[model samples]
Target chain A: MKLPRRRPASPKKTAVGGSPEATRAALLQAATAVFVASGYEQARVRDIAERAGANVAAINYHFGSKEALYLEVLRRQASERIERYPLPDPAQSATPEAALQAALTMLLSRLLADDQRGFVPKLLMRELLAPSAALPAMVQDVIAPQFRQLSAVVTALLGPRADAATIQRCTFSLVSQCMFYLFARPLVQTLAPQTYDDGAVARLSAHIAQFSLGALRAQRELLERADA
Target chain B: MKLPRRRPASPKKTAVGGSPEATRAALLQAATAVFVASGYEQARVRDIAERAGANVAAINYHFGSKEALYLEVLRRQASERIERYPLPDPAQSATPEAALQAALTMLLSRLLADDQRGFVPKLLMRELLAPSAALPAMVQDVIAPQFRQLSAVVTALLGPRADAATIQRCTFSLVSQCMFYLFARPLVQTLAPQTYDDGAVARLSAHIAQFSLGALRAQRELLERADA
Candidate 1:
């Protein structure tokens, strides 16, 4: 269902001067905070506008609608993080194993970095847990490419002998080990307090990398033996 | 913080007659539906009582408060599922490999069961995502024992040479693989439909078991080499 087309009855003056770019940027920033604090369903355009210091009509003027604004917020945050923490070129590492470690470390750095970009993980996780109209598009446009990249790395690590299904499961196992920290932060903090401490990102990435490398190498050996 | 003390000013006649056990059972049944539907914060005592056909006073008399009632619901559902799907005795399996697979199957069965007992997983997941007052106790009383059981199986597989931290990480890796299906069902359904279909529990159990076994065996070999 489309959100009601809410054109403010009377458009108010721009709070951040008459710069459309500034207004749009401010709206996106405010929208991120509002969306993160209260998920998609509960987030109010009025709140987003007020926080942005832009009029409600400014949201419609800049992003067309709240859903569109939300999509932009999600898309921008994802791209920004990927740009900041892009996967290492396979050639950069000594071996596929090192490449895998680099890839996992990069992914974990994105997922676990406790910094200003923190809102992105929280926002994405909210979308995952209680999905909104934006989920399908977000998965296809944003998540699928990242998933495919990781799959390619897994395929390389598993070698040509591994079946397609096996490659996919291995890819998921690697990703899940990383994503679980995002999905179950509270549980992890409660159960393994040390694992969730300041060194969590490094410690978890190393552990997942080693653990997954073992699984991948073993599976490769098994497939090789079967072929022989 | 304690829930405010609320005693119905006028205790009405019991809906399912004067039998305390009958009223209590009805209240529990109704409360599960309400809690599962609305979650802990939004669920109303009046609605639970009305659905049970009992008076509000019955809730107070039986459960003491809404928080207590919610805890009882969580506690009972957990115990019931565990009773219904207890982990296999380690002695029954020929090896730790078999035991690990058996344990994974048991866990996936409980997590993925598509039957009347569905409310428990949904309820438990809700608690995990948006924790309430009952979470710490639930983790301790319900989840920790199961975690310890899985830890034992993992330790048996990893061997005595591995350090405590390595064992803990490996245990979490195994669990995170199984739980990814639950926590990210929508993503799984969207990304790989086959993995979440009718045969999901079996397929997932097999994949996680094989993958985790490979990792465990590899770690064991690595540990052995280190000792040598």
Candidate 2:
């Protein structure tokens, strides 16, 4: 489906002219569209402002600079969206398969529900491809913490005997499974010629969960084999 | 480390100075760098020619159009690179673990070693991220055939008992393990704080092989459980 065309920002006013916060919100939304369309390096503040229907100066007033605005856009879109997917409560589930399923479901739902035209993942993917000076801050403040929390959940599920490399690979596999749909969607669609509808999504989720559980189970086996 | 900047293309002496074939090769190489840097949508033939040290007219003379040049780059760089990583000989071994390990080693080596300023994977990643009109031809000519061949190897290693989904997931896991490293190297470096030197490469290879074997073993167990 084609995304909505970019619209010029209206002056700071919601019908009767809303608050500055409203204007700021509008500007951020516009920034998301512009960034997704042109990528961070190519996105211009002027276009973003125009799309928001706010004055060009509004971006400076609200976000301080284009870079700051971009960072804020990422913070709002990527981090906040991820936060919506609450981590699985450990007290409720003791089984590794249950915890793994919960985590996989949360991840798949988040990836699938994100409807912004290439807003979240594309931004992150771009940063991954050609990192900028600001990457350390982004990684530290946003991404790393989430992954660490994920690792904790996974560790709890796998119990005390899991080795570091095993944990790392499992973590990589989980993230990679979710990302495959996003990063490889075009290629998959081209090759598979199947629409990834709800049915397809269900099938994919089940496959990923099973694949992950099996990997974890096998890790235990390998550990036991090593010991023997 | 920063990659070496593009060298100016020497002037054409004869059809052989760059014979028409030499001219074509130089153009494609230059086009690869430009495509990698700017992506297909934004890359210009003039820039490619300048990068290759040839006149803008040379592109028209050689490839006929910008799109043709782009396709040529994909064929030469992406498709040919895939071709280079030939399927592991089936007679070499039979165990699923050994077969997978051999295939993964070949895949990872090709992926990591070909990271010449992100030429090959970057191009493929771009196509994956945003498919263009030329994608079908690209996929048919370059990507699909290789994937099919790889899939057949995976299917054989998996034995006759594994169903289609299991085969697919295993194939996905193998590719994910290999591609994720190149795709997420920046994040990996940031989080791991370890150099991806020879030792790290060995560790990573071991990690992928073990992880993959674990997944395959898990798949077998799941199939058994289901059957029971």
- Model 1 Cα displacement at A134 (Å)? 1.0
- Residue-by-residue lDDT tens digits, candidate 1, A22-128: 67887988999888777776799999989877889989988888889988988888778778887678778888888888888888888889775477777777677
Q: What share of the true interface contacts does each candidate keep?
A: 0.64, 0.73
lDDT of 1: 0.81
Model 2 residue runs over 4 Å out of place are A1-27, A41-72, A157-161, A193-195, A199-203, B1-24, B42-46, B115-118, B153-161, B193-195, B199-205
Residue-level lDDT tens digits of model 2 in A1-228: 543323433333332134677678889888899988888767888888877777899899988999899888877786676566666674576765776677667666665654776476676677776677767877776567657766876686566788775676678767777777767777777766563765665677788787777667677766777777
Q: What is each predicted model's overall lDDT from 0 to 1?
A: 0.81, 0.71
lDDT of 2 by residue, B1-228 (tens): 544323333333322233466667777778888889888877887888877767899898888889888877776776566667676775686665676667667767766774566477777677766677767777786556656656776776556688876777677766766677877789877766563666555666677777666667667766767777
lDDT of 2 at A210: 75
In candidate 2, how many Å is residue A102 off?
2.1
DockQ metric for all predictions: 0.45, 0.53
